[model samples]
Target: MGDNDHSHPFFLHHSDHPNLVLVSKKLNGDNYTTWARGIHISLSVKNKLGFITGDIEEPSSSEDPDTHAAWRCCNDMILSWLLHSLKPELVESVLFSTTAQAVWDDLCERFSQSNIPRIFQLNRELATISQGTSFVSAYFTRLKGLWDELASYNEHCTCSYGAKNDRQ
Candidate 1:
């Protein structure tokens, strides 16, 4: 997706994390399931997957000052990255968040709704596709775009090797 390069730094904000692209704008949205999967993998890379899963808690002020500071820095960095990656309208909602997990949870709760109808609609369109009068290459490209978008909505096993195999 086009936004992948932008979201990379946020997930890799931690000095220890690997440098790699995450979700791009085209693959991120309420319309599909790819966003969640991409976020999961990104967080995993940073060893901060617990933030979204709620397995980890924000460090309290009463905790060790150094540990608390580090946690806050990491959370703030992640929140900043997420805020930067979102559309302007979406940014307003999570802009005030102090914890990265809070923003992630809010987004998930807001968009993770049943999308059965959208899936069916995409399927119907895919079924009706035809080369018609268009050149074969053009038709194939259009069909592949639809298939890629459809695949984004339906998460499946992703190959970790090769650019073409790595659908995420």
Candidate 2:
């Protein structure tokens, strides 16, 4: 397929496989924020984010047979990648999910907590964190990781504060 044609969601690189682990760290009941972020980046790079976001719907079997087969192939591939990225214990929970989105939503509901208590805990950790016996790089990495997770819990203002007021 041509470059433009191959950009479709159904298109998979020869190297792509169901057993591929999208992230170095598997989801182990904790570290969902970082793990999910890593998976999003990897899937986005593969042009498969839509599978988890429900943007790419499966074609009907009656629709063109080729199209239906292609969609099922891509869906199963994405599902396998998601399963491979989770810890063995966690995999059993999501193993039966038919779609990548179903597995994603299930995991998200189980681990994606952004409540006041969580935010306060992160802030407290940030305040007490120190280089201590750890190397400078390790300290910085830990601090940065906490900061990123906290930032993800925050909601950004969509209103344009810099825009000129019509009444002005």
Candidate 3:
């Protein structure tokens, strides 16, 4: 967990379990939730789910005898991985957070703006969007991207909530 040592072997998640997508170098505008989900699944596979779930409290010092030393180290490693995943511009904002859960919470708060006015504006734009003179395939691609963005923000389109929402 020391700043100078990058030798922590436990931090790397290289297995082919399917849901574990390595954090990308740059997480741009709307990719936060997707990135977070991947990180969560990967961490879960490592039995370190508590690091981001707030179940494991961050240790104040590695020297403290009562601390879960290995967990603390793993938590720091996870936080480091999360830091590496952020876009360079966003790194500064979350850097001050002490624990992985705090960082996760801060990111969720900042990026998960489901009730924001921008969602309404995006909806309006999508409703009025037309192919115009564009090629059919290109138009479809653009439309699909807009729909994906909408689904990411809308919450109900996600599989977890979709079933419950559908029954209502």
Candidate 4:
């Protein structure tokens, strides 16, 4: 078993299974940003980020049979994990995708578009958030989450003046 092989990109533990829910919340089309971050963190921890990132390419069938087989096994596991994370309606769209990277790219293209209404909603929530009956920590957490989501939609300026102003 390659479970103990930390250097191998396709290493999988005995417990790693397709039915494992990587993120608590399923991808339902509206929460792509947070859903993507959660999926990314989970896959990174599993040493399978390369499968979705296209960093790990599949071996040609003409290559060593064992190597190609191993790649296919890992890829199918990743594809299953991804499909399991999505809503039932969404699963059909990418169910036939041949590679994990293809499935990931399809989902990203479908849901990660710049949504103006969503950005407006996040900004509104940030502006209206208050402690109310919530504890200070809880209030702060809600506020921070909204800010972070809104920040994800923003484009950071790379100019020297922008950098200087940000530091200030």
Candidate 5:
């Protein structure tokens, strides 16, 4: 993959036939365990900005104050760092899974006019697609209007990161 091309693994329950692309030649060894349960794996689609980043961690119910604080800080730090690195000009409208729609909604509302270059969820599936580009496979098409609104959101983001590049 080139500097601009990145891919991430997205998982689904063993019986779930998710449509997300899987770039791997074969499933990971961990899937062997799930294979006993008949699970398959595939590569996830990538967008201009990058893939919709997701992580799998052991579920925890700990609600300690310090834990929550650290978690929140880590989340912000991750997004802040990505914004610095990828510096996406415009993010696609999100299409998060039902599991994450509320969070996606909050993001859309928070970044509504701000063009920090993030996608918003327009449907139940989290595919990072454009508003209407099949509503299925467009990750950066939402950027169509980026040039028109970037100046306004860049001001909200207040950073020089990826501010001087354009598609050729």
Candidate 6:
């Protein structure tokens, strides 16, 4: 997706993950579930980010938390998790998002200017990518609002059309 042009960037560092996790656990009644949404994102891009080949999860069967503070912490952890987990290839361009403003501010504070510029660029490119209706992109359009809010997966785009479309 290369046409969209609205990117909201924040900063992140590699060391914040475990500290966030521990702090999140201490204050929350339902420790893991508090961070469930962020964990979901982590699980989806586990391979894309590389270093995090697997999930460090929350209990799906438990009661909901009393507040969203745990989720806030989870979002922070997800960044650390991705930075530490991504394979070298994707590490330079990983993007973080959430509806929450606090999380956004946290990100802006952590990453250096050089770490993930591609992520910001990708958001700007997304509107264009969203316009394509290729077979695969069509599939995404069909699924966008149906399967767990497609907006959550910002990096996904229409699949490349094969050799017939190739430039000479």
The best-first sequence of candidates by TM-score reads 4, 2, 1, 3, 6, 5
Query: In lDDT terms, how accurate is model 4?
Result: 0.78
User: For residue 129, what is the lDDT in candidate 5?
Assistant: 32
For residues 125-163, write the lDDT of model 3, one tens digit per residue.
Answer: 899999999999999999998787667555522222233
Output the worst ten-in-a-row residue range by lDDT, candidate 6. Answer: 159-168
Which is the better candidate, 3 or 6, if ranked by TM-score?
Answer: 3
Report the C-alpha displacement of residue 90, candidate 4, in angstroms. Answer: 1.0
TM-score of 1: 0.57
Candidate 1: clashing pairs of residues: 3-24, 3-25, 4-24
Report the C-alpha lDDT of model 5 over 1-168, residue by residue, as the tens digit. Answer: 232222311222343232322332222222221221121121111121111123322124375555444334333333332222211332222222222222223343333333222322222133443466355334455544443233333232211233222210
Worst 10 residues of 5 by lDDT: 36-45
Stretches of candidate 5 exceeding 4 Å from the true structure: 1-62, 91-168
- Give every collision pair in model 4: none
Q: 74-101, model 6: which lDDT tens digit per residue?
A: 4455555534433344334444443222
What candidate 6 gets wrong by more than 4 Å, as runs, is 1-66, 95-168
lDDT by residue for model 4 (1-168), tens: 355896687777788888989999999998877788888889888888888877888888886788888889999998898999999999999999999888887776656663557877887897788899999999999999888877765432112223213322
Clashes of 5: 13
Better of 2 and 3 by lDDT: 2
Q: lDDT ranking from best to worst?
A: 4, 2, 3, 1, 6, 5
Greater-TM-score candidate between 1 and 2: 2
Q: List the residue pairs that clash in candidate 3.
A: none
Model 2: lDDT equals 0.77
User: Where does candidate 2 stray beyond 4 Å?
Assistant: 1-4, 114-117, 125-147, 154-168
Higher-lDDT candidate among 1 and 6? Answer: 1
Give model 6's TM-score versus the native structure. 0.21
